[model samples]
Target: MTVALWCILIAILLPYVCTWVAKISGGFRLKDNHDPRDFLDSLEGFGRRAHAAQLNSFEVIPAFAAAVIVAHLAGNAELVTINVLAVLFITSRLLYIICYLADWATLRSLVWFVGIGLIVSFFVVSV
Candidate 1:
């Protein structure tokens, strides 16, 4: 599969990674599984931020996935360019998560904008 396609998979899985981080930091247990949303909602500090990041990750997936797929279908952008942008988007997400966990609000927002810019770039390049 193309690297961009692989990135779609990574993007899909990223939220689960963030959720795991939140769960681990929040001391999730088997009982918590019965009310996972409540358990996650009750987290604070890094745990809470991680949960927020997880939700944000999920929120961005449709855009990222659609961007990648549309870019491929449009067939205007070079494969390498699409691949690089996809990698950069994933990198931005990882950094965003780290910034969220570390409470770097400004940096996280900047990284978020970068991710959004990358998504837009995919469409632009496809034109």
Candidate 2:
């Protein structure tokens, strides 16, 4: 597979990896159901942030994959740039999750924005 495809695969899997980390750290179970308020208290305040990252990651990744594929097929000049941005998005997500778990609210939000910016930039440039 090409490097771009590899990056896409990593982007696709990062959330699941984060979920595994959360589970191993005794944060939350994949199948567990609990009140959001209660879960927030239970996580010592990291629950919402981590949950947001997971949810957002899921939403973003499929779009990234589709955009990359379309760009590739169209021979769009932005493929390389999109791939690079996708890598940044994935790395920022990892930092985002760690910051969320660590309760670094401001930095966590900043990292989340970076990831979002990369996604938006990719779409804008690819089109």
Candidate 3:
């Protein structure tokens, strides 16, 4: 129950976290007046980064929900583990978004894998 709630909280908050990352990454500008090329480049890179984060959430959130629910149903996966994993997933996602925007390809992918792996492992163990 607590794990499900925390997952839900993190899921809702993750996108905003990504947006904040983009802002910090210099993707956000105050003025509309700027070079088209710069804007295009920023948009492309930021778009991809944001999309990657979104895709990660899409991949993991449902699995997190399913795993927690299944664990509850099956009488396994203690609340502590589930909540801790959920926090870990959220942290990994934050790291992934920052790494993506920073163009740290290897680190980004690794963070993504960790997040997805956490969810997938939960799925396997829950079932």
Candidate 4:
């Protein structure tokens, strides 16, 4: 599989990693709550941001995955272009998470835009 495909796999796991961070942030042995909202409400600060990161990940994933699939179907993708965009998207997301945790609102917002732009680039490159 291409590194881009592996990045997609990693992307699938990233939100769960964020969720885990949120769960463990409180320094308590709290089991996963049956209601996700309740779980989110219980967190504060970094944990809250981590939960937001997980939520943000979910929000972008469908578009990102769809773009990749559509790109593949379009059959004109330059692998290098796709791979570079995919990596940039992943990097943006990771940085977004870090910025969120650190409460860097300006940086986090910029990274979020970068991620979205990268996802759009996936579609553009496929054309």
Choose the strongest candidate by lDDT.
Answer: 1
Q: Score each candidate by Cα lDDT.
A: 0.97, 0.67, 0.67, 0.83
After best superposition, candidate 4 residue 45: deviation in angstroms?
1.2
**RMSD each, Å:** 0.6, 4.0, 4.7, 1.7
Better of 3 and 4 by lDDT: 4
lDDT of 2 by residue, 1-127 (tens): 6556787888788777655554445455545545533543355344445655566677778876776676566665465675677677668878977887788889988887787777667557755
Candidate 3 achieves a global lDDT of: 0.67
The best candidate in terms of TM-score? 1
Clashes of 4: 0
Name model 4 segments beyond 4 Å from true. Answer: 30-37
Put down candidate 4 lDDT per residue, 1-127, tens digits, no spaces: 7667777887888999898888888554545455667867788999998998899888888888777777767879988777788788889889998998899999999998988898888888887
Q: Write one digit per residue (lDDT tens) for candidate 1, span 61-98.
A: 99999999999999999999999999999999999999
The ten-residue window of minimal lDDT in model 4 covers 26-35
lDDT of 2: 0.67
TM-score-superior candidate, 2 or 4: 4
**What's model 4's lDDT at 115?**
89
* Model 3: colliding residue pairs: none
The deviation in Å at residue 88 for candidate 3 is: 1.2
